[model samples]
Target: MKIKEAILGFMREQAYKPMDMQELSKIFDINKEEYKTFKKAIKSMEKEGVIVRNRNDKFGLPERMGLVSGKLQVHSRGYGFLIPDEEERQDVFIPSSFMNGAMNGDKVIAKVLKEDVKGKKCEGEIIRIIDRANKTILGVYEDSKNFGFVVAEDKRIQYDIFIPRQKKGDAKTGDMVIVEITQWPEKKRNPEGEIVDILGKKGEKGIDILAIIKKFALPEEFPDKVEKFAANIEEEISKGEYKRRVDLRDVRMVTIDGEDAKDLDDAVSIERLPNGKYKLGVHIADVTHYVRENNPLDKEALKRATSVYLIDRVIPMLPRKLSNGICSLNPKVDRLTLSCIMTIDGSGKVVDHEIVESVIKTSERMTYTDVTKILRDNDEELIKKYDYLVDDFKAMEELFEILNHKRLQRGAIDFNFEESKIILDELGKPVDIKPYERAVANRIIEEFMLVANETVAEHMFWTKTPFVYRIHEEPNEEKLHHFREFIYNLGYVMKWSNEVHPRALQDILEKVKGKKEETVVSTLLLRSMMQAKYAPQCVGHFGLAARYYCHFTSPIRRYPDLQIHRIIKEFINGGLTEERIKNLTSIVEYSSRQSSEMERIAQEAEREVDDLKKAEYMSERIGEEYEGIISSVTSFGMFVELPNTIEGLVHISDLNGDYFIYDERHLALIGERTKMMYRLGDSVKIKVTKVDIDNREIYFRLTEEDHEDEELEIHDDIKESLKSGIYEEKVMAIETGYHDEVE
Candidate 1:
């Protein structure tokens, strides 16, 4: 066994009794020659927080030392919270003074200063730093005479990195740069670093997005060899390739996507069977055909894992030559595909299915807008334009409804929150920001892709073949308890037992449909659930309520899908040989973890870009008044989300009628004197008070009328009942979805 594991085992056997170096050395039979190595291992373990020294001057596990080991999440204000790696452990708050030398995102050992008390945060002090999260930080350089500092773009990084004059490199003041840390901060010193590379000037057209790309370490361009390989691949299928695959080029398939989407990785074709069933064909681009295993292109795609969709552009997983060229299921061009053909009955049951490698020719490239106009809106002009495919479109609509109904019946939790769509001009300045509505056409494609993915996953799973599966574990008890309390405060009761099911949450969502708090409730519920990730094991997805799930649809944009495509191709050619299976077992496991981590990085980068652009958009609208709904209420303030989906904070100090007292249980800011309250989902007018471009934050103040309105006051008896916590239980039992119903 490894030294660390051996030490842990020995400690566990000893009932976690404290052991000094000499005792451990004697117990492990360490000779004089090996004692130095043994001591080094113990020190390493201590530094990693795996073992700690107690007041008795003997080492034991952190639990025995009354310490916790977790990753530190630092706030911009310098204080941080240690999120314990243990699932059930509560986060311990670390005050700035107790941080020692640990920085943001450090994995550290902490000693509890104060135990969890009612209505108070658990406090802790960092005792040791185990690991650092980042060695390089992306920021804007501010040059001075003898030295300079780089202020991090990420606000969570509390310290500005100090760069020596000679280490500034080619970067100038106000230039966006990447700084590599040479020395960490001490008691009275900032982090010392040197400029690595200058991205570009701040406020440049594409520089803002580039800064986020650099921050996340997302590769923007493919390597020369990878690009060359992709460019040299034959665009057309050869005669030998055609003979090896099922020829379905004559099949009436159509690629449905947004107009600007170039990576059309999936296409659909549906036929009404004479037996009153539907044959749904989901054809996905077979990217593995040209990008073979262990090739440069394949390696690059594996590293990328997923494409990033920013406000103005996309950093594709594959080169444009493959992603937007050969791999894209373009119209009227012969392309290779792995198709899932399912025979579904009228009730949307997959009676029979076949997964095949085929060559296909897309009949048309249809945009969501055009398809929605033709099918949902029944626009005559669009119907005329696509006269040849109206019946097919109608058939697709029929199957979509049937499939959607089947999914809903299975207790799938669908949180249909509108995404923010920012439109930019040629210069990349935000021209408008609005909610991107999902039309019925989008749902039709989604339903098709989901069924195909599930079918493919089930097929592979039953074969006992190693593969990547999209897994969403059930929410933990603590999160569910908090969610239950939150929803209960809003006058909604969810059926709870020893275990929380998706249906319970789904049912609550149904109850709140069309209510003012629907969006807020949905967002909170989403936050409560665990993130879906690619795993080597099939742990059925909780949100989708699916026993089998995989990303088998978009191979061009997602690496997991591409990796599975390669495995499916190998299986189709022949059952996996022992040699191939052995090789694939490790590959699949590694790919699952790498892809999950990369996907998260891409998502975070995308969100950062979106937030930056949104802040810039709101900056232009400063002083403009807008009607908004209270999305969340905290002790310091309430966050209000406008109709356009731009959220801004309204500070507690701005609620001027009376001193506002925060009620945690009710999720409201209650006025001490007048008994006026501002709760989640309450409508209020707010002016864009200030926009912090650097921090990507918008600050707001309640309109004077909202503060002075006497009609918004609550009765004294109700206030007294709330203060005593007597009304909360009654409110929970009251079946009221509207916020005004409580009043």
Candidate 2:
């Protein structure tokens, strides 16, 4: 209360004047009885350094203001923000010109310059770069006469690295390569580097994978010694090893994954108990049994953290022999596994569970497409063609429907998304792009795995065992509020409050089901939420709406899962001491950070591949008219995604026969001469104008009615509202007519 009074009092005194106890009492307009109390407040303020006390019994500004430290988050524009890791509310702002060699994700110290706004965080300038996350640069090589330059793939790098000729080694021009940063010049904008390794040519099969690995500073290849060590691991499952664990070899366990998936990580089995509860078994590949702790293979796995799933291939954390062979839960083979067996009631609530080391013989391997057909179609001839899987598929389908309903009743959100799959030819070119199918059998497997993971997490938490948890914290309150405002503008109401649960957002998603703006709203809602990350601390998962969750189902692909398997095994065997668990507390946190970085790199590489494929697909379709929905809006243009999953930008000039204006806040492009508008999610027909593969850009134009087609022009008011210079540059249209007779 006193601090508030001081701030208000200081604001009133604009001139250079100091306040004494007598003057402060007059400002409060207090009686003589409270004069002594007001004097004590002034003395307290002086002691606290809120105001400096001079020898004349007057107070003035202190020598120093507020200051704080946080990790620097540098954007592509060169400006940065210091996001305090803990309780500091206001982020320190560092202008682009003040960022002293601070790269993105770097830890830095900031000196406060001034407060940004009333009650907001203070703005500051980055004075020192305490640390850098950019140790290695992944770029395309450009060879020169005496030296070479590495053009960074990351747009945020802002400058090309000047590589020394001697350090170029075998790197060739246009090769995707990794360069080590040797020194950063004090005055120059660019940093000097040396080419450490040549990855491959751009667009090559493995180049995207290599680029992502280098981007995250993750290792691409397994070391020679580690590979040798993994190669020596026998595929044989001995009887002695099986005797000490649960033997689920006789149970009808199966693995359901994508047709292209080779590294089978988990298998599942289910049975109804006498009490009407289901006993679900999640059998995960026991990589720890093959690769011992602290060995070369284990060490490598820890460093890599998790498997990178690119568009076409997977860069596994462990060597191929371990991930794809010895530890893979392939069908018809006896494999060692860390099993989480849970007994759940009809409501999908777990009543009992156990983490057991086991040997499982997978009965069959199923694909999502095959199972989807069995469940959706009743064609007698088709069923006869796949008679072997008909019965098992039906059983899996029934179980999935039951569990799904149970999950829904328990307030779980069903965010069924359309995932894209690339079909490649022998030459590695994308022949077709299709939506990935998620069948009932896949859902069955997923449900069983979720139950197992939750059971394991709950057990560990209750036992007070130190372990890694997959945590998804709440979203930023301001972001959620903005999302609510955006949704309200789109004629959809969203419920939000400081005390709202994750389930509340799920409720909004359910209400928007089948709406025209579902995709846009869903995408925006996901952006408003925080990302899930690995941590040693326990926090509820917002996306899944689960109190306890961990990645225990994909050990072959995720290193953290493998580590969890080892920890569970240690605890089950009663071999872990207090010190061992204590060490795991820190180990989990480190692995979580590394795993998150790997995931980010993988996502970037996946996007690159998707963009390339989209460009290729749109190349032949130029000038063909197709209906599409506006997916995004920008100052330059509106992006529309065709039904084929290809998105192209429609320049604002082409919005109508007239000029257009961009409403930045509302994200709409209005016609200048006309009042017509093209906002996000609006449906319109667009013809493919151009496809630039090198730049990963596709351009489109609105089809007009001149002689052969029907079209509408922008409204006059909308056209008149447009600002000049909105379309300063002219966009060229692509020639779509085929030249069969030109030869």
Worst 10 residues of 1 by lDDT: 734-743
Question: Where is model 2 poorest over a 10-residue stretch in terms of lDDT?
Answer: 734-743
In angstroms, give how far residue 655 of model 1 lies from its true place: 1.0
lDDT of each: 0.86, 0.72
TM-score, each model? Answer: 0.89, 0.81
lDDT of 1 by residue, 649-691 (tens): 9988777878877766667777766768888788899999899
